[model samples]
Target: MILEAAMLHVKEGMEGEFEAAFRKASHIISSMKGYIDHECHKCIEAEGKYLLLVKWETLEDHTVGFRQSQKYQEWKRLLHHFYDPFPTVEHFKKVAKG
Candidate 1:
């Protein structure tokens, strides 16, 4: 499995709106090919910060399959505007698990 992580810094005063939008946007990603699951975490210390984690079967499942699909456009429209500086996404493979 491939783990995709992004640290999202939403625009100030838009946190609530962003969360509502994300709930709607979640469905778009969940329906994609190779999608395993995803989580959105709100930061305790930072008012407008969030952590997004998504699991996919392969790197291309996200980079190519999802990002290249029309669904991505909808995803972007629903959630992208909330960011201040756009989040950088990274992928990881599990090394050890408890």
Candidate 2:
């Protein structure tokens, strides 16, 4: 599995709206090819900060399959505007698990 992680820093005062938009956007991603699951986590110490984690069967499942699809345009339309500096997404492969 490939783990995609992004540290989303939402625009100030738009946190609520961002979360709501994300809720709607989730469906778009969940329906994509190779999608396994995802999670959005709010930060405790910082406001307007979120951690987005998505599991995919392979790297291309996200970088190409999803990002290249029309659904990605909808995903971007729904949630891209909420970011400040724009999050950087990275992928990882499991090394060790408890």
Candidate 3:
């Protein structure tokens, strides 16, 4: 599996609405082809910061499959507005596991 990670920063005072919209957006991603699992965590020390980890069956599954699909438009609409400067997303393959 490949992992996609991003540090999300929700707009100030919109964390609640962002979370709600994210919950709705989550379904859109999970239904995509090659999607394995995902997690969204809020940072304790940072009010508007969050960590997003998503597992996909392969890199193309995300980079091409999902991103190219119309579902991505809905995903963008659901969550993109919350970001200020926008988050950087990176993909990684497993190297070592304990």
Candidate 4:
């Protein structure tokens, strides 16, 4: 499995709206091909910061399958504007697990 991680910094005063939009946007991503699961967590210490983690069957499942689909356009429209600097997403493979 491939793990996709993104550190999201939402714009100030838009946290509530962003979370609502993300709740809607989650459906868009989870319905895509090769999607396993995902989690969106809010930071306790930092306001408007979030941690997004998604699991995929393969790298291309996200980089190509999701990103290239029309769903992505909707996803972008829904959630992308919430970011200030824009989140940088990266994928990783597990090396060890407990």
Query: Which candidate has the top score in lDDT?
Result: 1
Against the unseen true structure, what C-alpha lDDT does each candidate score? 0.99, 0.97, 0.97, 0.97
lDDT of 3: 0.97
* Local accuracy of candidate 3 as per-residue lDDT tens digits, 28-73: 9999999999999999999999999999999999999999999999
> TM-scores of the models, in the given order?
0.99, 0.99, 0.98, 0.98
Question: What's the number of clashes in each of the models?
Answer: 0, 0, 0, 0
Name the runs in model 4 displaced over 4 angstroms. none
Which RMSD does model 1 reach against the true structure? 0.4
Kindly provide the TM-score of model 3 when superposed on the true structure, using C-alpha atoms: 0.98
Order the candidates by lDDT, highest first.
1, 2, 4, 3
What are the per-residue Cα lDDT tens digits for candidate 4 across 1-98? 99999999999999999999999999999999999999999999999999999999999999999999999999999999999889999999999999
Segments in model 2 whose C-alpha atoms lie over 4 Å from true places: none
Score candidate 2 by TM-score against the native: 0.99
Minimum summed lDDT over a 10-residue window in model 1 is located at: 76-85
Q: Write the per-residue lDDT of candidate 2 for residues 41-70, one digit (tens) a residue.
A: 999999999999999999999999999999
